[model samples]
Target: MIREFDRWAYDNRLRAWRAEWKLIVAFVMLAVVMMGGWREQWLVLIGMAYWIVARARVPFSVYGKAMLAASVFLGLSLLTLVVSVSVPFQITFIDSQLQPAAKLAVRSLAAWSCLFFLLITTPAPDLIAVLRRMRLPAALVELCFLMYRFIFLLEQAAAELMLALRARSGGTHWRHGGMLMYQLWMKTWQSYEAFSRSLAARGGVASAGHTHQREKAHVPLVDVAAGIIMALLLGWAWRKG
Candidate 1:
């Protein structure tokens, strides 16, 4: 899935548009995503889906898979906020936690969708280039690139672990799931250590092309107009509500 996003990022319909343009749109919508209530959140989510799926020409299935993968993590994190997930698995939810949990869930999903828009349309290195152009700290920018690289490493490790567990063919016990995660953690660390060793030997910097080259990319006027209109409507809805 990570590969899919990166692949599409380079090949998407929005590739010709300025990466800065996409960044601005995503960041501005984040303001509305954070400040506005559920109504604004829903509107932003729909609008982003249209941009990513329809306008950007990303397959709906790929978007759906990404959302489902994201939702698992989101749901578990939110679950812990409202319900205690300790030993014995008590299904307890405080009355006060429910409302805030719902709000947080809505906010997080909208935010993730905005990020997906960016990830699917802009290459990872290009984004790093954008950050460097903005004068972001070099250390922070390098960290971002390493993290982006690890997503692929982690995915490969997870795929192998799943296959191994399936071959073992045990009962559907909770411990099996835990063991899979534990093995995955160990495998990932080993791979990371090997990567570090080889990188140290080479003395070459990671692939974050330090040259922040600018391209004369075109920004579509109609798309800009649509974004402005959507932002205005979301703002109006937030204020009126």
Candidate 2:
């Protein structure tokens, strides 16, 4: 899970500065090359995968599992791009459609890999701190903070509820699943209401602001130079594409 990744990231030497630079540089190149050709996208994907597996030292199993989950959703969404329906509801693949779908799939995979690299190498708190330093909107940052905090809380609550249900039912069933889902929703809503009241009690939403000032991070000059090189490469790829 993400919590395990966070712990691993903090224990590793590549936690803050290197991870932040890689995150920014990788995504910038990804965005630029994503607008280019499939060749460029594939290049970006390979570079990112190498950095993640070799440089960042993320385990292949972790990367594979994450990509597999993403591919499932990406494949489903891409079905519309590749498949067309005829008058008789016959599904057909047009030759022209294949190119666009391939381009999209490559670009998407590159983007997802870049994102996963950042997620596995940087903890949420450090990432939020970086975002704050980058002058992101306070409200948006705060929303993300709350969402991150509550996701674990909600997951724990759901797990406990499911365990109780299983103890009573002896096994899972459609009816049990439905009951568990309903209870989870109700619990989530109640928790949100309580949080809202608590926030209200402490003046207003504006008072919920928490300053995230950490020790100044020192990004290596080499990384900055590399980022510049990547930008130039992306420009060339764009023109070539």
Q: Give the Cα lDDT of each candidate.
A: 0.84, 0.73
Query: How many clashing residue pairs, candidate 1?
Result: 0
Tens digits of lDDT, candidate 2, 186-233: 999999999889877987766234453254477556545755665677
Candidate 1 positional error at 5, Å:
1.8
What is the alpha-carbon lDDT of model 1 when measured against the actual structure? 0.84
**Model 2 RMSD vs true structure:** 3.5
> For model 2, what is the C-alpha lDDT against the true structure?
0.73
Candidate 2, which ten residues in sequence have the lowest lDDT sum? 207-216
TM-score of each: 0.79, 0.79
Tell me the tens digit of each residue's lDDT in model 1 across 143-190. Answer: 998898788888988888888887888537788889988998898889
Clashes of each: 0, 0
Write down the RMSD of all candidates, one decimal each: 3.6, 3.5
